[model samples]
Target: MNHVLENPVYSALRTGDSHLAFGTERIKYFNEEVSPYVGFAHDDANGFADLYELLPEGRRVLYAKPIPAVIPQGWQLQHEIKGLQFVYEGSKNIEGDFSNIVSLADEHVDEMIELVKLTKPGPFGKRTIDFGYYHGIFDKGKLVAMTGQRLHAENYTELSAVCTHPDHLGKGYASALMQHQLQIILNHGQHPFLHVRDDNDRAIAVYERLGFKVSRPMNFYFMKRL
Candidate 1:
């Protein structure tokens, strides 16, 4: 049996986040509005079949593992991303004044999307904020930096979308936001983990300073239907 954290997205939807999950009993995916992640109940042929049936033609999804040799019917591989998984080993977040951080809500989605567009943190969409527990810092009434939850397995939750608008970098916004989310995840008795591209050394260093250590290399495959 695979460890639950190995396939956090699918395990999340199937277990802790069923309300946000879609697809068959054997596979699960977030609605395109919330996330592009798709997870297989089991990393086997049957799991691939379930994804093929769930996604529409040309729809792309993030698979937790590397591309499998067996391409299921009606699906074509778009590309594969080699990613690194970082897990926070610290039992508690370092003390920081998350005082300026505000709980983000639906009204803030537009600003959140705009921030993501400018920062290129990762895939983000209009409804992604529905995943909840997002916090952001506003300066001059503008939303400049933010971080929030994503993949959720039983014992872990993913800290995702950590980004600061270009003009806001070096101001400690990213660090503050990260600390905020980390504390939230820890408070719930769950460890927070995250994924980053191998080439993103700057962000990786920041995470390391915050007590996250590299756990393993993971793969992200984007697929579309043939």
Candidate 2:
């Protein structure tokens, strides 16, 4: 497979148009109340320099880097790099049985909050839900696995917030939900991409087996909050 195909982060950076950086892409949001930049590189040389220059003097730019490989010079290794993969499906074929969790006009917000908590709870997750468009897996009337989309840049839509409850894992729930979401995104004439830690061998293997490829190594830099 091609290098970019092996590392989705690089693909996102090269393909995204709203913002530009060394190895990261900008997922623009409509809300002016929020910070303009959401996702940053874990080991982005040019991006880090740009961000550092943009920060106000004496103020720190706090963030995390998901490094795909060795630490680049001038960058302090804060944490281990994680595997990042990309999957593209021309047409989604959702198999098995999985119920979709709809967030109507009135229920969307609360459902989103709950879904974020159930997934990865953090500022990133918050930013994701704020962009809306999330789906959940229902088990006996309870929300289980969920897959959603975020960060729209032209014809590219990122497939994110894919999570399954611990007790509900190993049941093919995540793959099914993701396939469903991928189909929807493709139907809109857009491609799908996502990020995963490099050390996540199991997840990486699963994605590769499902036709996803390791596009390129991406770095997630985690700066100390000021």
True lDDT of residue 194, candidate 2:
67
TM-score of each: 0.92, 0.63
Per-residue lDDT over 1-226 for candidate 2, one digit per residue giving the tens place of the 0 to 100 score? 3333333333443455234332223321122222123234334446555544444433322232333344333444444434454656433553445455444233444565575576652223334454445677677877776767655544667676677777787988778777677667777777676667777766666667656665555555444222
Worst 10 residues of 1 by lDDT: 64-73
Q: For model 2, what is the C-alpha lDDT against the true structure?
A: 0.52
Number of the top TM-score candidate: 1
- Candidate 1 per-residue lDDT over residues 1-226, each given as its tens digit: 2377777777898887889988877777888889888877544667776667667777877677633344566777777777888989874846789789999999999999999998888889888988889999999999999999988788888999999988878999988899889888888988789999888988999999988998877877777765
What ranges in model 2 sit over 4 Å off?
1-80, 89-123
The C-alpha stretches of model 1 lying farther than 4 A from their native spots are 66-73, 91-93
Give the lDDT of residue 58 in candidate 2.
Answer: 35
Worst 10 residues of 2 by lDDT: 27-36
